[model samples]
Target: MHYDGVDYDAGMVIGAELKNGKVSTQIGFSVQTFIVYNPANGKMELMFIIKNGQVFLRTIFIDKGTIEELLIGSVIQSKNYQAGNTGFKIDGETGIAEFNRLVINKDFKIIGDASKIVLDNTGLAVYSTSGGVIKLSRRP
Candidate 1:
């Protein structure tokens, strides 16, 4: 998590895994904004969360190529994540990676042991335990 080759501003990482469990990274962006950037590629992963009078941002940045690759891979793996009412969703705008397909699920988990699941459309597969199904053919 580096931006422009500099250490990521710790405050901008929300819901980021840390020494004290899944704590929200704290950055002062309108008291409700934080941005994540992956140094490897130079793209931006942005996320925002507000809880108990506090707002946090969760995002990641890397090169477009990397993001694209990730998206494609996500599409393929999405299928594996589906299970007994659990599903996922993938928007075309997400990327051309394997997992660009949208997924959907019900009664899913987001933290702890059930964080993310990987699937393989070509080789390996993965996915998340969240709700919804992978939604493709509707994105730009």
Candidate 2:
């Protein structure tokens, strides 16, 4: 994935284990930039477990000396689609970051989180709270 002129490889499974019909795993990824003076080194960790037909996802990001975490609730998957919501906390305030729908047909699209609509072809098309509709395309 490429963001902000930096290239990031796909996440990898760091560890995995299965026991008693349950499976747990950890995935990690790194984001890096080329500039030495203005460095941007970020790491992301995702931990998930599957038990009794239920799936939970937790994602944590460490970037530029800051930490952010997202604890996603149960994931419901259908043909070429999945949806879920994650616990979101900012500045000691808490809420849910709802991912109402994610459709992956010929392209990817996500709609939720207080009127936030993100399309794979368009970075952030709508942000209601910010009152702006900015369209950014991924750099090849």
Best by TM-score: 2
User: What's the lDDT for residue 3 in model 1?
Assistant: 78
lDDT for model 2 comes to: 0.43
Candidate 1 per-residue lDDT over residues 37-95, each given as its tens digit: 45555655445556557655565343555333332433333445444223444534453
lDDT of 2 by residue, 45-107 (tens): 335554455554565344557438654454322233333233322221222222322322335
* Global Cα lDDT for candidate 1: 0.42
Off by over 4 Å in 2: 1-113, 129-131, 138-140
lDDT of 1 at 69: 36
Report the error of model 2 at residue 52, Å.
Answer: 20
RMSD of 1: 17.7
All candidates: CA RMSD in angstroms? 17.7, 21.4
